[model samples]
Target: MDRLTAFVSGAVQGVGFRWWTRSQALELGLAGSATNRADGRVEVVAEGPRPALEDLLARLGEQPSARARPGRVDAVVDLWTPARGVQGFRSR
Candidate 1:
């Protein structure tokens, strides 16, 4: 399994980013949580197959929702090591 933490910026908050992420992650069978950060960024941490993680990142960059417009979505991803098991994808 592979783990990744993605920090998504731009017009993310209040635009259903977290919900979109949760739906996509669940579809990919990834385990993680997508949360809104106090700094106006959305934080997504996921664990699953490397290919699935890569696919999730691609979907995020491609604007998974109609609410995410061009030049309004960006993400920074980093390899992560989870301290505990993530049961399922969630929105926070």
Candidate 2:
């Protein structure tokens, strides 16, 4: 499995980005969370099969209504083993 962390910049917050992200991630069977940063960016961390994770990232890049305007996505691939279970994706 591949773990990914993406930082999205632009008009992402207050635009249902987190909700959309969670929904899409669930559809792709990814486990992670998205949170708004104080720097006006949204940070998303997801872990799953490589292909599925990529698909999730693609979906996030094009969320139709909540997609960031003039957005920038920075992604990194790593390995993560959650000490405990992550229930569901959430906005925090």
Best-fitting candidate, scored by TM-score: 1
Model 1, poorest ten-residue lDDT window? 63-72
TM-score per model over all chains: 0.82, 0.72
User: Each candidate's lDDT (Cα)?
Assistant: 0.80, 0.70
- Compared with the true structure, what per-residue lDDT tens digits does model 2 show for residues 3-58? 77887776778877678788788888888898999988888888777788777766
> How much does each candidate deviate from the true structure in C-alpha RMSD?
3.0, 4.3
Instruction: Give Cα distance to truth, residue 51, candidate 2, Å.
Output: 0.4
lDDT digits (tens) for residues 41-68 of candidate 1: 8889999988898888888787544534
